[model samples]
Target: MNDSEDGRVQQLCSHDEEHLITSGTRYSIKGFRFEPPYVLKRAAGHLCRGHVPVVLQLFFLTLSAVLLLAVLIKGQAGMADGETPFLVTVSSIANTQGQEQAKKEKVYKEMSQLKPQINHLCRPCRWDWTLFQGNCYYFSKFQQNWHDSVTACREVGAQLVVIKSDEEQSFLQQMSKEKGYAWMGLSDLKHENMWHWLDGSHLLFSFMKYWNKGEPNNAGEEDCAEFRDDGWNDAPCAVEKYWICKKSAMSCTKN
Candidate 1:
């Protein structure tokens, strides 16, 4: 308890306190300051343990939202620029193809409708001509002499009708029933008493020589043959009478 002892003990205590405060200290450099290594380490440990994972999750979520927004904006801009989307373009092309196919089918159907129908059971003949079996006949409406009648038929690319059967004879007999007389293809003008067709062809069948009772008597120098409702008869070549013309079925096919 002397005064010197007391003062020395007090100075030692003060020095020890100052040394403790200054030891491991941080210093300010210009406008920046640094923490001691131990303090910085404690702060980093708190951030890693408590808040770093939450901050990372928030950053990722924000980035994902920004990316989605950008995609939506691009799609809208493409639509506004009049650019067709992939699905829309495909649909439009398909529609155009369908229309073209429909047009082609319609044209084909029209052509089919317009085409002529031909079959074995039925045949066509020219207008104003009658079809029977395999031949077509044109019954004239005006009267002409035998030679002039043959010329008239030849002018139309046909020949004077030749009666080949009793059926044809009956048909002709019925056709000129109203007029009562029609010049036939039979003629003896080339050689008297020898009957022949307009083209100088002889009659092939003996049964075809049907005559009315006692006719072809060569009366009045009758050289041409004409028919009435009953049967054939010889007459003058200059006597005018309605005639008949004939053509094959093949020649009338265009009808």
Candidate 2:
């Protein structure tokens, strides 16, 4: 509105709940002079005379809305720019780092589950076919004729317990637990005294080889092999002692 009209409204608005007389008619500002009936009349007059306070308020509100919208858009752009580095690091952890971390956790969980059983079976020598810690190991305590032992292990889901390395040999030596002789995968019955292991280690030092001297003594009848607590020996293949048998853990039917 022009300064005069704005001045009139401003004055009328003061000392709320007081009376105002403009056109020889009395009016009181209970809450505002801009109540509906009066507001409608004044609005119509202002439209005719181009003096509307509500219209001014509408313009100010529109300006404030535009400013608020601009501020919101700028703030969103700023946040997106700063978020790039954080997104990169989160990908590094989730895609690459998270995979490695998951694998490590799985290994640790398996090891924790297996530790006690492995310690029981493999601390000395690990048997490849039996469940020890979280895996499997094998140990046989019965004695059989050489051929019979081989067949027995196979029949129940095992083969000759193959020794892998010097480390393994030493371990088995320790686990032989009995001070007696234990048969291994070595034989020369076809060549009589000229022996070789299945894995092709020549019958080297029968020194610790537990031989009963007059043993394997080329006795054309000795097709069998035996050993003693003292050393290795030869006997008939028909004899049976506490021979070792092994199989997969699942195959262990012994109750």
Per-model RMSD to reference? 23.6, 17.9
Q: Estimate each model's TM-score.
A: 0.50, 0.34
* lDDT score at residue 167, model 2, on the 0-100 scale: 52
Each model's lDDT comes to 0.71, 0.51
Which tens-of-lDDT digit does each residue in 1-255 have in candidate 1? Answer: 477854664464344323323364444433233333443334333333334454553353355446545655665666666546687889999999999999999999987876655332344567788888778888898898998999998898888988777798788888878665898888887788888886667866664557878877998999988877678888998999999888776543334
Give a tens-digit lDDT track for model 2, residues 106-199: 9999999999876565222343343432223345565666787777767766655554445544544554545345555556766766766555
Clashing residue pairs in all predictions, respectively, total 0, 18
User: Which candidate has the top score in TM-score?
Assistant: 1
Clashing pairs in 1: none
